[model samples]
Target: MLPVGHFAGPMFIAPDAVEPESYEVRYEDGVFSLSAAEYAVWALAHGDPDRVGSHRPTRQALTAEAEATGVTEPAVTIDALISDGLLALIEDEPAARRAFAERHQLMPLALGLGNQPSQLGVFQIGMPNTPRVSVGYDIYHMWLFCHRERTLWAAVQEIAGEAQEANDAAPAGDVELIADVDDLLAGLIEALPILLSTSCGFLDPRRPSPTSAPADDAAGSGDDGRGEDPAEDHEHGGDALVAQP
Candidate 1:
């Protein structure tokens, strides 16, 4: 089975609908049999879907509900639920599942700097000697440049011209020629990842399900292809252009 955090993709089912049967959780050893309700509780508390809230149940609420339902121990029920993947536990009460979804719906892209140009440009432009720009950087600029590269370049040229004129008119070192360079780069970086992630087919489309086989057996029938590792193929299949900032 895939490791817990390795499957960080969004849950395909709604939080309420994530019962144990919704997934097929298996163990490498032969000692566990988790029910649907149990799986649902466990997933809510421990799976990637539960990361936003860490799946912690409210103690007081759980106690009250358990008492009303005639259950002797609410904690035991909660533990059972966790084992089955039905519920989750989080550190902060304010960051429950609902709140977590509200706060962190998207996966953070590899880009680290802020979205502003002053922050993003230093990485996008690079040294100019490389043939292909970093995929990550190019993806951002390409999105911003969509149907407007010429116009954008023209604007940059105009700005550069203005900067040049200011430098010529002023005393030496008076004009900072690279003043707007930061902004220019940021604009490009801001848009690249959105474009690439959405359009470039770099990310896997399949939901990370436990039932999924490691590889497509039909496609890898021949000896030469059969010996190759599926995991390595998946990792290196794309040209993930890495740019050094």
Candidate 2:
């Protein structure tokens, strides 16, 4: 008998989404859209495929769970997701644990902050015991956590490797290291879309909250103190002024 599996890795969830009536999942070139009813079953059983055997729920049980979440789908999305490799069923508990740990062998060598570039963090979504995240900042550092960290880094390395021939023309010494660093940054930039979808950008404790509402003074900039609409007053059109840097 084929055992059930959950999502192969973590994916983002909307903070406002409790039990989505419909869900659309996109991975690389693969896009799987789910209706709200179908998605209820999926959401109920998703996350932690490796441990599914320990607490297997019957399709009937899943249907009830879905209905409780306000969904009435008959649980068709489960089979579809398992077939896509988006969810992989691992029957061995110990083996799955080993697989998860051995998957990523690299760690951050150092940590610092700036407007510069590095691998962004990967986030796990809907995982058991893990808090749901919705931070949307594109942090320059690898501060998020995702199941695909090593896979992404490996791809980045291959891309950056293509630039080695150009670096060979320069004098050796530290040039190789510098070039590699440049390549790594370039790779991160290239992988921006992947990171954005798969992970949550982390917020720095030092930085002010980006989501804070604008103050009264800043919000009404260019408007009269009486709260006139600046744009409305300029119906005659305004001149385009270029400012010096």
Off by over 4 Å in 1: 1-57, 93-206, 209-245
lDDT of each: 0.31, 0.33
Give RMSD (Å) of candidate 1 vs. truth.
18.7
lDDT of 2 by residue, 124-243 (tens): 332345423322222222333222243334433443454465567657663342235334533333332222223222100011123543223221222222232211211121111111
* Number of clashing pairs per prediction, in order: 33, 7
Model 2 score (lDDT):
0.33
* CA lDDT, candidate 2, residue 117: 41
lDDT for each residue of candidate 1 in 15-100, tens digit (9 for 90 to 100):
57532222233221111233322222323222122121232234455445344434444466466544322233333332242222
Which candidate wins on lDDT?
2
